[model samples]
Target chain A: MKDETDIQTPDEALEMAKKSRAAAADAGKKPLVYHLALPAIVGCLIASFALRDGLQLAVTAATMALLALVLWRVRKRGVWVGNLRGAVSYLLASLLIVLTLAAMFAIFWLKRTYGLDWPAAAIGAALFPVMVAMSLVWEKLRHRDLTGKMS
Target chain B: MTNPANGLEPLFNAPTRLQITAFLSGVAEAEFAVLRDMAGVSDSVLSKQLSALSDVGLVELRKSKLDGRQRTWAALTRKGRKSFAAHVAALQQLVQMAARAAE
Candidate 1:
């Protein structure tokens, strides 16, 4: 609407750029619930693996339903990041997936080999904090990237 | 004439537009109200700038119903993202150049 050719000196341009970066970082910030949602889902799924055949299915179904609800609420929040972008983001996400799968497998192994009663629940509990830490790290890295602090 | 070699985009010369694009760059889509608040501009001002950006195919707007009320959302087009990234790179370059010149 205003004049398109509004020019700035180098210093002003730099400052404006910095301000823009700050705005982007702010826009990207999410609530604590967003950070906690996925880990909670994963923790439930891991805990589900320890259940009896019928209960495992039920728990798995419930976990998926919860995931759907979380996604719906996120959409209703009016701002969506969709997925983190860039190679580093992809790498971290992939690492998280691998870690989750490994945890589940470890639970299975412990249950079969040692007939442990607490393997699934214990590992699932451990994963909640680990996943939360990873989530926080991912957010920190994403913020750094958004703010142009990475380079 | 603005020199193309400087890598400063004419479209982003306006600070409001630059700020809007920067915010859009971070999110996939944002509600109109959220963007308005972030930009700290009047609805008319933001609408005008968004319209300008839409005209140039830099951004897209969508309307949807939420809680039985109409809402608008905005996001950068692929072109917009590429352009914004280039503009940021150019700005960084300018800063670097200034530092080198000072040295």
Candidate 2:
């Protein structure tokens, strides 16, 4: 039998990557969706009300396409395919964008039903930046937590 | 590193080197000790593996002072990244062929 000190096959590299991906999760960049979600949501929401009926969806589609392009371009950065869990984490990250959109739509529904003004939209749109701020704050906290022990 | 386009990199066949490259491919950089821990190897073994990687220009190790203590970090170069991708593709191909053969 081959021992642990033996040379790893190419397949072994893949298997090892799949195995250690979770414990090493903190090493890679956060999923791309985390950075793009709020902007995409805010863009669609504003486009819906600010633009004319025909232009509303067109602008939203264009914005989404732009977002997709950007995401594709940056996809290779810090990409690590650890295992099924890592893959699922990325999948869930993208799915969170849909959830964010759903929340924005809920606000749109309120505006249409209750005759709320742009003030409501403004407040709703403001949440997107708030989310960004909170995530940034949390990221800093996590960074400090990670680095503090090391230094 | 061998030309990934040509074939799988035999260089990374060693378990320690494979583990190091695999982990570094995901992150921008990691402390040397972190990588050593990840590879589950001793100082000399990881140092030797890292030297091999560095010799082939697959990885770059840098030393700096952090909090008055010397710190070393390792990162995969662009060539390293391409090689890793190619090797992974080759591995996937082999797996598919094996599955098909078994079926």
Task: Compare the candidates by DockQ and give the number of the best one.
Answer: 1
Error of 1 at B75 (Å): 2.2
* Candidate 1 displacement at residue B28 in angstroms: 2.6
Clashing pairs in 2: A8-B13
Off by over 4 Å in 1: A1-7, A85-87, A104-119, A148-151, B1-6, B95-103
Q: What is the interface RMSD of each candidate, in Å?
A: 3.1, 9.2
In model 1, the clashing pairs are none
Best by lDDT: 1
- Per-model clash counts, in order, read 0, 1
User: Distance (Å) between predicted and true CA of A137, model 2?
Assistant: 13
| DockQ-based CAPRI category assigned to the predicted complex of candidate 1 | acceptable
Top candidate, metric TM-score: 1
Write out fnat for all predictions, comma-separated: 0.55, 0.31
Give DockQ for candidates 1 onward, in order.
Answer: 0.45, 0.14
Q: What lDDT tens digits, residue by residue, belong to model 1 across residues A1-151?
A: 4343567765676566667667767766777887788889888889877788899899899989999888778767777777586788888889988988898789878888998747787788888988888888887877878776522
